[model samples]
Target: MEKLLTIKDVQEHLQLGRNRVYQLIKIDSFPKIKIGNTYRIPKREYLEWIQNNIGKTVFL
Candidate 1:
């Protein structure tokens, strides 16, 4: 089964602040899903994003 991650999970994985995560989503680059007021990200999507941005500086 595919893994689903919460905002906190993404923050922990990326070691970023809550605001930064939101900013990434706002920029439409981060893999995220909005269910009402909550945000969830698929583990695969997060991994893909990491791979896609590899070698680039991710300013958080």
Candidate 2:
């Protein structure tokens, strides 16, 4: 099974706030899934995105 991350998890992992995470989610390149009203991020894809976008400043 794939590991899933919640908004709070993303916040902690990225050292960002809740609203910042939500803002990132609005960006087209952000890797996220919306199920009902909750947002879930796939750990693998999130990590991949980070690796691929290293040094790129994400403005949100």
Candidate 3:
């Protein structure tokens, strides 16, 4: 089975603030799983997200 990551784990891995992560989720750019009031992201999905965003700048 794939590893599941908590919000905190993702924040640390990406070196981003909680609010930033939440914001990303709001924009649907970040992959997230909502379980009750908590959020989780699959390791594979996270890796895929990174790969998909590679070399893509926010400001064009």
In order of appearance, the predictions have TM-scores of 0.81, 0.93, 0.84
Clash-forming residue pairs, model 2? none
The prediction achieving the highest TM-score against the true structure is 2
Over 1-60, each residue of candidate 3 has an lDDT whose tens digit, in order, gives 889898789889989899877777675677788999988899999899889899986421
| Per-residue lDDT of candidate 2, residues 1-60 (tens digit) | 999999999999989988889999998888999999999999999999999889888888
TM-score of decoy 1: 0.81
TM-score ranking from best to worst?
2, 3, 1
| Model 3 whole-model lDDT (C-alpha atoms) | 0.82
TM-score of 3: 0.84
Candidate 3 stretches with Cα past 4 Å from truth are: 58-60
Candidate 1 per-residue lDDT, tens place, 1-60, comes to 888898788788879899988887785788887889988888998899989999998764
Best candidate according to lDDT: 2
Provide the overall lDDT of each model, using Cα atoms, as 2-decimal numbers.
Answer: 0.84, 0.93, 0.82
